[model samples]
Target: MAEQLTGLAGDRVLLGRTSTAERVSDILRSRISEGYFPPGTRLSEDSIGGALGVSRNTLREAFRLLTHERLLIHELNRGVFVRVLTVEDVEDIYRTRSLVECAVVRGLGEPPYPLQGLAAAVAEGERAAVDSDWKALGTANIHFHRELVALAGSERTDELMRSVFAELRLAFHVVDDPRRLHEPYLTRNRELLHTLQAGDRRGAERLLDTYLADSLERVVEVYRRRVGEDGTGAS
Candidate 1:
C-alpha cells in the first residue's frame, strides 16, 4: 500500500498549494477507480496521510467523502474499507448506465459528434490488449465509457457517472477471468466508435445499448460466482 502511495506523490503537486479534503478525495477516488485500492481492502489513515503529507483529520474527511460516494464503508471498530458491491448494485449500475449513455448518444445533435475522446479510449484499449495487460484493458474500457458520457457535455452528468464508473470497477476487480470479461468489448468499442465516426448515431446507440446489456450480464455472471449470494467474497 505504501509503495502504491509512493507513485501518487506527483499527484500532490497537481493539487497545487493547499491540499483540501476535496482534492484528497479526488486522488483517492482516482486510485480506487484505477484498481490501486481494490474493493474490500482497508484504507490506512496513518500510511496514506504520511504518504500524501496530509493531516489525519484531512484524511478522515477524505474518507468521509468517499464513504458518501458509496466507494468506501466505515465499520464501528474495523476501520474503513473499500465497498464490495452486490449483484443488485451491479444491475442498478448497468440500468443507470444504459439510460445515461444511450441517451447521450441519442441526443448527439449532429454527425461527427466529438469523436476525439472516444477514439483515444478505443486506441488505449487496443494498446492494452496488444500488450496482454487485461487489467489495463479493463481500465481502458471504463475510460471508453467515460469518454462516451463526456459527449453529453454536461458536467453534472459527468460527475454522477464518475462515481458510478468507480463503483463499477469494484465489481470488475472481483472477476476471476479478466480476459474473458474484457476481451470481447474491445472490438465492440471500436465498432461503436466507427459507427459514430460515420455519422450513424442510431447505429451507435444500438451498439452501445447492446454493449451495456451484454456487459451487465457478463459481469453479473462472474460476480455472483465469485462474490456469492451474500455479496461477500474471499476477501
Candidate 2:
C-alpha cells in the first residue's frame, strides 16, 4: 500500500494550488475506480495523506465524501475501506443505470450524434483485448458507458453516473473471470456505436437496454457465487 501511495505522488501535483477535499476526492475516486484500491482494501490515512501532501483533515474530508457516494465505508475503529457491494446493491445499481443510461440514449434528439468518445473507447477496448489484458478491457468497457452518458450534455447526469460507474467497478473487482464478464460486451459496444453512427437512435437504445440487462445478470451471478448471503466478499 505504501508503494502504491508512492506512485501517486505525481497525481497530487496535478491538484496544484487549488487543493481541496473535493480535489482530493477526485484523485482517490479515480484511484478506486481504476482498482488501485480494490474492494475491501483499507486506505491508510498516514500513507495517503503523506503521499498526496495533504493534511489529515483534508483526507478525512475526502473519505467522508466518498462514503457519502457509497464508494467507501468507515468501520468503527477499523479505518476506511473500499466498499464490498452485496447482491442487492448490484441489482440497485443496474436499476439506476437502466433508468439513466437508457434515457440518455432515448433523449438524443437525432442521429449523427457526436460519437468520437465512444469510438475511442471502443478502440481502447480492442487494443486491450489484443494484448489479452482483461482488466484494462473492463476499464475500457466502463469508459464506453461513461462516454455514452456524456452524449446528454448534462453535467448533473454525468456526475451522477460517474459515482455509479465507480461503484459498479467494486462489483467488477470480485468477479473471478474477467474474460467471461467483459468479452461479450466488446462486440455489443461496437454494435451500439455503429447503430448511433448510422443515425439509428432507437436501435442504439434497444442495444443499450439489452446490454445493461445482460450485464446485470452476469454480475449478479458472480456476486451470489462469490459473496453468497453474507453480503461481503470472501477473503
Give Cα-based local distance difference scores for all models.
0.91, 0.92
What TM-score, to 2 decimals, does candidate 2 have? 0.90
- With a 3 Å backbone cut-off (N, CA, C), the pairs that clash in candidate 1 are none
lDDT of 1 by residue, 1-235 (tens): 8988998986786465345888999999999988899888999999999999988888898999899999999999989999999889999999999999999999998786888998899999999999999999999999999999999999999999999998998899888899999999999999999999899999999999989999999998898788975578632
Compute the lDDT of residue 132 as modeled in candidate 2.
94
Residue pairs with backbone atoms closer than 3 Å in model 2 (clashes): none
Residue runs of model 1 more than 4 Å from their true location after superposition: 1-19
Per-residue lDDT tens digits for candidate 2, residues 134-165, read: 99999999999999999999999999999999
Once all C-alphas are superposed, what RMSD does model 1 give against the true structure?
8.5
